[model samples]
Target: MKTWSSIILAGGMSRRMGSSKALLEINVQTMVELLVEVLTPFSRKIIIVSNEKDYEYISSLFQQALHVQIVTDDPLYQGEGPLAGIYTGMKELQDSWYFVCACDMVKLHPNYLVGLQERLHTEIVTKRQQYDAFIPYSEGRVQPLAGLYSQQKETIKKLLDQNKHRITEWLTHMNYYRIEPSEWQGWTPISDVFFNMNKPEDYLQICRERGK
Candidate 1:
């Protein structure tokens, strides 16, 4: 079976953090940079979608990956959220599945991703399934932002046709599978690794955790 591709969703408004969340630094590296590093081994390609103004700095981060496209949304589709980025990335990628991730998850543990990897391998080995989506649920809730999508070209067109702009809303319309967090062992703090930067205090706390 062919390996799937990935796209990192980096266009959040980051209102509470009061700046671009994609640019937030943790351990001397930008959040998006860290995310790209993690996904580098797994992705066939990496794409970034945000306002052109917001991406100029980020575009320079990967000097070697000229193959990784950094795209700006068409003004007509401004502020439509992560779904817009997902649509844009899926349109350009040839892979049947795309692993999409949010940039703000700095505390993310590698084990969570390993769990998803195991699922992919299982699907390939057992069912030989052709799923349209794969999302993980930790403690009964789905993390739509951190999930794998078998982003079929036809389904993407349907989503665009419906004018769906929310990730959660569209996930409801797809044929997908969700795994309980416990299904995977060695999973770390559900909250710590998923700590979303909300305010100045959150950044301070994360800095302290990093021993800064």
Candidate 2:
């Protein structure tokens, strides 16, 4: 398997949910905890990006966990959104590739991640250099957060320096490998795979679906 690290962005305001969504419980596990569990099987290094206050709380929860790093946004780019989190993680780990996702993601399909890793390995071996990322594209939307990124420290740093913080717009300018919905059919519905608990209603919906 190709070597890689992961970043979990947990610094959102959570205004819609009216509370820290990263700490929200689903299936008896906090959202952040569940995400760590899901990614632990795939990568040895996992970074959780949050604010200083949240970082303390999150770090306490995993004091004994191996290879988990809880980090606050880089001081220079504080509050710059997920793009900053990605940039910070890339700078910290300096890994060849990274898998980034949000804390609000309710389900992460391991099988699909394995498939993505395989595809990334092929791209590396074939010297496919046109793209710097491998992201999911479905229903006319690109899921930037739940994708794999090649070393993009400089690209991300340039965007942060220019005060352009929109992740989707940044993605548009980069050459990326798009994993179409059809490619994810057998593992799970694409919608479910990318399901995000962005609001109270969304959280309730997940609870209901899970028979909670």
Candidate 3:
């Protein structure tokens, strides 16, 4: 298995949820904790990007998980959105590839991730293509956070430098391999893996679905 690093974007204000979604409990685990658990087995390092105020609290929460690191948004890109958080993680690890996701994601399918890794290997090693990212496109939308990225720290920096915080816009400037819905639909229901809670109602809905 190739080495991989993971980045969890948890810096959002959670205005709609009225609280920190990262701290929300699901199946007896905090959102970030569950995400860390999922990534720990496959990741060499897992970075949680949040505000500086959350550094100590998040660090304490993951004390037993030594491989996990918590970081504040880069000063220049504070509150810039998921794109900035992604860039911060890329800078910290400087790894060849990254598996990025949002803190509110309730279920992450490991089988799908494995498939993405295999696809990435084929493109970069077998086919000798220079793709900057491997992202999933589902439900007529591009899921940038639930995607794998190449070492495009510089490219991201350029975007942030230009005050461009939109992830989709960043993709346009790079050579990316997009996994369409047709490619991933058979493995599992895409909605389950990509489910994210953006509001209190969404959280309640997840709780209901999970029989919590």
lDDT of each: 0.73, 0.86, 0.85
Q: Write the per-residue lDDT of candidate 2 for residues 1-212, one digit (tens) a residue.
A: 53689999998888889999999998898999998888887785999998776888999998998789888899999988999999999998868889999999887777778878777878888985756889987668888988998888898899889999999868867889888888865645445788889889999998998888
Q: How many steric overlaps are in each model, in order?
A: 0, 0, 0
User: What's the C-alpha lDDT at position 125 in model 2?
Assistant: 89
Per-prediction CA RMSD (Å): 2.5, 1.6, 1.5
Question: TM-score-based ranking, best first?
Answer: 3, 2, 1
Worst 10 residues of 3 by lDDT: 183-192
Query: Tens digit of lDDT per residue, candidate 3, span 55-155?
Result: 78889998888788899888988999999999999898768889999999887876777777677767868777778788888777888888888788898
Instruction: Give lDDT tens digits, candidate 1, residues 96-130.
Output: 77888777777667666766777888887898766
Task: Decide which is better by lDDT, 1 or 3.
Answer: 3
Write the number of the candidate with greater TM-score, choosing between 1 and 3: 3
Candidate 3: regions farther than 4 A off? none
